[model samples]
Target: MAAPTPVRRGAARHSELFDALVELLLTEGFAHLTLDDVAARLRCSKRTLYTLAGSKEQLVRAAVVRFFARATERVEAAVAACATPADRVAAYLRAVAAELAPASARFVDDMAAFPPAAEVYARNTAAAARRVGELIGEGVAAGDFRDVPVSFAAEMVTATMVAIQQRRIAGATGLADAEAYEALATLLLHGLARDPATPARPSAGCRS
Candidate 1:
């Protein structure tokens, strides 16, 4: 991907501010957080914050989009490091879990409260679902998984992801998002498991 537009004068300071803002969002959630709160936390003025974006909502939106962009990079890297399709699938989910592990219940609720942030998160979810579909296709082609219909399986996993994000299953089962993702990896792969007696081949369509 191309580089993102510069947000501030110094790259280092910009990164620091983004990280601090993310921490605040994760701790306090977006609903109750204010421009003043961000300024106070960063030891800066509201004017200084404004230099980054036009308004409070815009600032948060930019930060959230940046955060998810970085997360996607990390997840892609993690998946690429694996040798097999099964491993790639596991790596992808595990990387996602790690990225989301810091998010608390309040943080997720806050994202729902903010439309811009919610939209960014929803886009991330859609991308993840597509990636999962690709991995499943690779596994099946490599004889590592069953011959499940790619579209149907992908939608099923995507629907489950949406449920997980909405906290529907998590609220009822008391599972954190990260835990839910791990469980999903296990459940999907186990259900599609191929016999160990057969030799597995690398998928030509999948690169790691």
Candidate 2:
């Protein structure tokens, strides 16, 4: 076997650094930490950290982007394994909750305070809303859900997600972010369920 090339080695090191950076930010946040602090915590030199990004703000933003990119991949994988539209919807939201389970409140607050990181989070939230809309549409087409306005339902879900991210739901309901996501999934599934009295139509391609 050929030895690993320098480029491959550098890429592996960068991936390791990114994973460490994301773990640090998710648990402890970035607003209170300087670049020096990050280097110290990661047990690396400032020069090495610069290889990832030019500044602390940019580094945090990159980490945020990496975190969401990984989370989306896992969430989609979970959704794809489900056999029915309802199962897909539930798996998507629950997978999101599992992915976010590691994010501390401090990290969430820091993201809200940092404009660049916050923007990344906002974009991901919007994407998640669009995904939910697609799942809901599938459920409706399959007769598993009511034929409600897809856009309206998606918008409502988006509002709830924003509230959860901003901690409004936490403040009002005392639910953690992960718990809130689980609740949202349950509520959405229940809300979209077909009425018991309604006759069941043979769903095309839906598995029991």
Candidate 3:
């Protein structure tokens, strides 16, 4: 068998380190985390950690990005596995909840408090909206959903999720992010459902 390429080997190493960092980040917020602290926990040298990122902030950002990227991949796969568009949307939201279940309150708070991490989260949420919009478009094409403007509906969902994440809605309504996402999926799916008694609306192409 051929030896693994340097890039592949590096990715494997980084994956291990990222896993450890994620666990620690869940328990401790990014604001109080340091390279040395992570190095000590992972039993790796500071130099080893520096190989992945130039600084602590960069490291945290990289970890957050990598973690969410992996989670999104999982969600997309689950969504694709569903036969119907409604099932796909539900699968995506459920996959997201499963991915986020391990995150503690401290981790969520840290993502909001840290600017770099917050930016990573913002990008992830935007990507999710685009994906959801595509799913809605597919549903319309399949005659499984109402002829709602996909872009408008997707933006609404994204905006609502952001509000929940930032604690704006959560603070006012006492709803957790997970609960908000569940409610979002329920509301969106219900609103888009094609009535058996009524005729389907005309298709409006809704691309992300």
Candidate 4:
């Protein structure tokens, strides 16, 4: 077989670099890091970093977008593997929590402070809420959920998600963001369960 083309190799390298950058930001936060710092952390030259983004702010924004894009893909995969609507919903939230497990408190705080990154997070949150609504509607139609208003239930979940992202839930309940997501999944699934005594079926990759 022929070796990969130059363009393909470059694209692959860019992807690897971006993954490293996102991991770094998620672990350490971006607010205190300069371009030099980032370059040093990634073990790449500043020129290579510029190839990904023209400026530090842009790089951070791009990383945030990439993070959520990857996360959404994984979350959807989890939901798709589920056979029941209730399990899909539970899987969605559980996947979200798993995706967010790597993010540190500092990273969350920095993302909130950076408007571009924050906007990306906000958009993802809204999209998640809509996805939850759709899942709830499906459950209701399947007679798996109670006759609750889908819109209201979705909005409540959205509000809780926002609070989780903002650290309000942590402040109020002492639950970390990921922990809050787990609790949300449990609460939502139990509340929506047609038989309160029966537990929602766990989906692939989803914990109890």
RMSD of 2: 2.6
Worst 10 residues of 3 by lDDT: 199-208
Query: What C-alpha lDDT, on a 0 to 100 scale, does residue 77 get in candidate 1?
Result: 92
Q: What tens digits encode model 3's per-residue C-alpha lDDT throughout 10-108?
A: 899988988888778866767777778789988999999998899998999988987898898988888767777888887887677777777777788
Native-to-model Cα distance after best TM-score fit, residue 96 in candidate 3, in Å: 1.5
Candidate 1 per-residue lDDT, tens place, 1-208, comes to: 8665564336667677887887777777777778998899889888878877889899889888877898899999988878888888888888899988888888887787788988889889989999999999987887778778878889999999898877787888999888999899889878777766766565443354
Candidate 4: residue pairs that collide: none
Q: Which stretches of candidate 2 lie over 4 Å from their true place?
A: 198-208
lDDT of 4 by residue, 104-123 (tens): 98999899999999999989
Cand. 2 TM to true fold: 0.93
lDDT tens digits, residues 124-185, model 2? 98899899989998888877789999889999999999888777898899888889999999
**Where does candidate 1 clash, by residue pair?**
none
Model 1: CA > 4 A from native: 1-9, 196-208
- lDDT, residue 165, model 1: 73
* Whole-model alpha-carbon lDDT for candidate 1: 0.83
The lDDT for every candidate, in the order shown, is 0.83, 0.90, 0.81, 0.91
User: In model 4, which runs have C-alpha deviations exceeding 4 angstroms?
Assistant: 196-208
